[model samples]
Structure formats: structure tokens, C-alpha cells
Target chain A: MPIRNTDHAWGSINKAFHWILALLIIGMGFLGWYMTWLPNAPGKIKIYALHKSIGLTILALVLLRILWRQFDRRPSELPMPHWQAVAARGVHIALYGVMLLMPLSGWLFNSAGNFPLQWFGLFHVPSLTDGENPALKAIAGITHLILFWVLLVAFVLHAGGALKHHFIDRDSTLRRMLPWGTRAEKSSPPPAMTATHSTPNSSSPTEVKS
Target chain B: MKTVLLFVLASGFCASAGARDWSTDAAASKLGFSGTYQNEKFEGQFKKFDAVISFDAADLSKAKFDVTVDVASVNTANEERDGSLKDKEFFDFAKFPKAHFVTSAFRKAADGSIEADGTLTVRDKSKPVTLKVKFSEAGDKATLDADTKLNRLDFDVGSGDWKDTSIIGADVLVHAHLSLTAKAG
Candidate 1:
């Protein structure tokens, strides 16, 4: 597989970003949920700080992913029903939107409260607001809190769609995006697709290792 | 300004004799404080504070100041921090609505600056404090600018998590800038 994306599969760079963000988002969800429940203590503050730092990291990585996407072509959409394809596209868009927006809302909430922002405690990030703005602070904080639910729903839908393609329809939707190598044809195709096709595109018989 | 002119004239006429009383222009004065929050520096001001001033350049023994600051008026530019600051673990504004400062004596420093010895009362604790003062008397208006450093822990201002000074420093720099008008004798 190539380092850059191909017409049929994702690049290593894209896959790395996808999985890394996925893991971080999952971790952040737990941290965010747990920290709010903790009693007001020094330990809670530390955890909150860590959450901010990791959230900022995710924000930076999301930007890089979007920027890379500008230069990198996406693999063609797998063949599916028109409604499923549309739903999949909507889910993907919403996921990307949440990924980009979550950090910004957090930053606004921080800035609106005129709170300190440090990138992993290395340096400060400039505040967006001038001073203590009660209205903006409340609004931004609510937005930040609410977006977590949006992220969770979008993630479930996205993952569910991929699984559906893998199990029910049995296509290359999931395999093309998988981290490991598989010919996407030999082992990944539905039994019906394999039985009908004799001429496969490119490559000799590479062993399927999924 | 008319009062200021009269007070200035009075002070000038009696400069050789005694200390003159002055009143602060609340609109033109500020009581500010600053400290670090993590790696970032945060600044705040006490919006409601009143100071009574009596001073003479030559009469150090007679110079005195009494100030009352509303603890609940503390604004750190951060609303969450400001809210947190008023809680029981911090200023406990519900219990102690006011902080007080009173200067008992004044002395000229070796560097020809002035220092006022005083006691600052915050929450339930009182501590001896000294304010480094730069008292500049303009022709018609006198300005009283003073600065002092305070340890919040000294007064039990920050109790629970705030004791971790590494995250939020215990040392707070308090500054006062009062636009003063002399009161006629």
C-alpha cells in the first residue's frame, strides 16, 4: 500500500490520523465526563488541565487532517444503496464538523471566562474575549458541553455504517480504511462478488491476512 | 476641580504646619491585583473600595490611611475564577464581605521613597503589611499610588485546592491608585 491515498484505499497518514483521533476522542470523552463529577480539588484541577491540553492537541491535529485532506484525494465511495450512501456522507460530514468544532467551543468557553489557556503547560494561548463576559461564557460553556453528545451520536452512526458495510452488504468499505494490509478483493469481498468476478484489477494473488 | 483648587491652595498655605486630609475620587481611582493562573498571568480589580487619606510630606507621624474593600467585588476578568474566588474555599465573601487596611505609621526609605506600615485584615485574619507608596501631589489634584504584595494563605483567603501554590501562586500583588482631592480644614 502507498503512503499517499490511492483511488481504492486510504494512505498510512490518513489512517494514522483517523485512529489517533479516535483514541484521543474516546479518552477525552471519559476524562471530560469523569472530571465534571469529581469534587472540587487539586486533583480535579489537574485532570481538567490535562483535558484542556489534550483537547487542544486534538484541535491542532484536526486542523492538520483537514489541511492534508485538501492535498490528499479520498478513495472513491464504495458502491451502496442511494439512501445509505447519502446517510453515510451526512454522518461523515457531521463527524468532521464535530471534530473541528469541539475544540473551538472549548477555547471560546475558556476565553469567555477569561480563563488561562496553556498548550500542555508549555505556553499560553491568547484569549478570544477581552474580559469576563458572563453571557458569552455561559453560551460557550453550554455549547461545549452539548457538542459532546453530538460527537457521540455522530461517532456511533459513522462506526455503525462502516460495520453495516462490512457485515450486511459485505463490501470493501471497512477494509479499504483498515490499518493493516489486505488485498480488499480476495478476502474482503462478499461471497457473491467473488463468485461472479474472474478478472480482478491490478496485483497477482496476494495472501489475505485480515 | 473647584474643591481641588481650594484644597490645593489650603495645602500650599499650610505646608509648613500640619497634615492635610484628602478624599479619593472613586471614579478616577482603581484598586488592582494580579497573580499567575498556571502559566498565564491573570489580573483583576476591586471595583468597590473606599479610602480615607491624611498625609503631609514632612509629618510622617501624622500620616494615616484607612481603606475598606468589598471582597465580593473582586473581579479577575475570569467569571469562573471570580465565582470561585468568592466561595468558602477562597474569600468566603458571604462570611467576610469586607477587607480592611489601616496605616499606623509612615517612614521615608533609604531610596527617598515612602513606606506605610499597616495591618491588612482579610476574611478572619489580620496581618501586618507594608505598602510601598509613591505619593505625587499634582497642582490641583494629589495622586496616591501604593503597591504591596500579599500572601493569600496568610489570611486564609484560599483554603482547599488553592493551597497548591504551584498551580495558582499564593503571592498576590495589590496595587492602589487614588486620585485624591484635599479636604479643606
Candidate 2:
């Protein structure tokens, strides 16, 4: 429940950011698809506005999460193979990249369409263009969609890896990221540091950012 | 002799107040509207509209403006938005194809500009509006620029779910600029 993350577990702030962003992003996925099925009408406009507002909310949360990461401590990676560790890092980096790019592209798409942008009806967001830009609109629209798929795949791998660690490997990686999840005692880590899943030297437990 | 001279002078002054009829030079005129959508202001125009102007600078109180705008001809540069604009919750082009603005009274403003009080009818809803007008004349040619603001909700322009004005603003600004040529007397 600490404000700042410790060397072995996520802090309250990071956990909130993670879960809140997760729910919102998932909600956006549903909203994005649901709105497409709607007939073009005044109601559709309102739905699109709602989608934009939530997307903007996700964007802000992603930014705060990244900023907090810079000043927070990273729980050391659970003993795992060099290859699996490297793959995990790659997935995390990809997720972070899209975390920023996804909302930004959505914003560009809205702006290029010359649609008004507002954040939960609280304030206005400026447009990327002065008027409708067909070329930019097409490009941004495609990028926004592609990023959605990219994020889906990357998060799948990321979550799958965490589950693998928590279940098959019986490691504490997944728990550390959960809101109320706790880290295992460092003294008796599950027989994880063997010759199979990881190289011997890689288990030296150097602190790493996830 | 003095009374006869005074009467002749008064009659000449009254005759000068007679108005000249003018028609719009559509090529050089524009009838547009703007509104704040979620705090971002956007503008749109009526592509097909006409105005009949009758006026005399000597007596603006006698001036009149009659304008009719094709609601279906609205173009906001975004087709999707324009489509929404023509729906029943907005302009309802199917039911009311044209919107009208006609002046009933005119008065001079404190700033020396003229104010035209008119009734604007849109989507079968009518509301009294005042257009702050600036007019100028050169020879037989004249130009008129006027603008007014109204609450869109008052006319049921944003009905249904769009009735929530927190996202889209309620106030809409309508404007017109016209170049007119006097008819040959």
C-alpha cells in the first residue's frame, strides 16, 4: 500500500494506474466496436464523443504511469530464462509504445476528420489540423486500428507470460503486478533458478524495470 | 408665404425617405453559421440562399431584409456532420427545406450601426432575433454584413440524446454578408 514502489512489489499508485487503464482500454475496445454497429445518427455522434473522451482518459493515465515509472523502483525480475526475460522486456516495451501511440493516433484521426475533441466534456482538445485532411484522416484512422491489434497481441503475450510465471513456473511475477498481490519471500523462490528455464548467471537477480 | 415654403420642404424630405429595391448578387454573398462544439468552434454555410433588400440610408427604420435559406444545402466541409445537421433533431430538411429570416423592425445602435429585429424560422420553430447590421453604399451597389446568436436548444435543434448541451454547446452564431445591386427605377 506504499505510494512509491518497493524493490519487490508494485506500489498502490502503479497498481491503480495499471488496473484503471486496463479497464478503460478494454472498455474502449468494446465501445469502438459497438459504435461501428450503430446507424449514423445524432446518437452515434454522442457515442463517438464518448469514445474520444475515454480514449483521452486512457492517454492521460498512460502518461502518468510512465512518469511514475521513471521515479519509482522496479521489482527485480523473477528468476527466468535469458530468452524469456528478453522476450518479456520486448513485450513490455511494445505495450508502452502503443500506450502512447494508440490514443495519439485516435486524436489525430478525430482531428483530421475535423471533428471536435473534448475530454469528458470538461475541456477542449486542440485539433492536429485546421480543417479536414483526407490524407491524414485515412492514415491516422488506419494507424489507430492497427495499433489496436498490435496492443491486443502484445498484451496477450505479456499477460500469458505472467500467467506462465504464476502457474507453470509457480513464480511471483504475476502477483507483484496485482492490486493486492504480494511478492514471494526471496529466500525460498520456487525451484525456478535451474539449468532449464534460465542460464545460471542470469539468476544473479539484478534489479530490472518491467 | 412662409407656411407654403415650410410645407414644400417637408414633402421633399419625406420623398427622399422612399426606399430603393435591391437584389442579392449571389456570387459575392454568403450566409453562414458557426457554433461551439465541445468548446471548439466550427463554421458551416448555406450553399443556396437568396435575399431581397429594401432600404434607404436616409431612414433605416424603413429598411427591410427578407432571406430564405435552403436547409438541405448546408455544407460544413464534413459530410457526416452535415448529414447529422439535416436530421430531424437538427434542421429537418425533409420537413422544412427552407429557413427564413425577415426583418420586422430596424433601429440604430449606440455604435452607429443598425440593428434589424427579425423572426427566424427553422425546422418549423420560429424565434425573434436581432441582427447587428453594417451596411454601406457606393453608387447603385451596396453591401450588407449582419450577424446574430441564438440558443439552438430553443428551436429544438438538438433534440433526442443531443439535447445534452454539456458536450455540444447550445449557442449558435448565424451570419450573413451580401452584395446587392439596386433595381433600375
**Alpha-carbon interface RMSD of model 2?**
2.4
DockQ of 2: 0.41
lDDT of 2 by residue, A124-184 (tens): 7888887888899999989999998999998789878888877997766766667673534
Candidate 2, residue A9: Cα displacement in angstroms equals 4.1
Q: Return the TM-score for chain B, candidate 1.
A: 0.89
> How high is the CA lDDT of each candidate model?
0.81, 0.81
lDDT tens digits by residue: candidate 1, A1-210: 677886556788888898899999999999999999997766777788899899999999999998998998765555545577557667777778888889899888888777788887888778888866779888988988889999999888888777887788777777777888647633644543443243232322211111
Model 1 scores what on Cα lDDT?
0.81
lDDT of 2: 0.81
For model 2, how big is the CA root-mean-square deviation? 4.7
Q: Is the docking of candidate 1 incorrect, acceptable, medium or high quality?
A: medium
- Deviation from native of the Cα of residue B108 in model 1, angstroms: 0.7
Off by over 4 Å in 2: A1-14, A38-47, A71-73, A79-83, A181-190, A193-209, B1-18, B59-62, B104-113, B126-129, B183-185
In TM-score terms, candidate 2 sits at 0.80
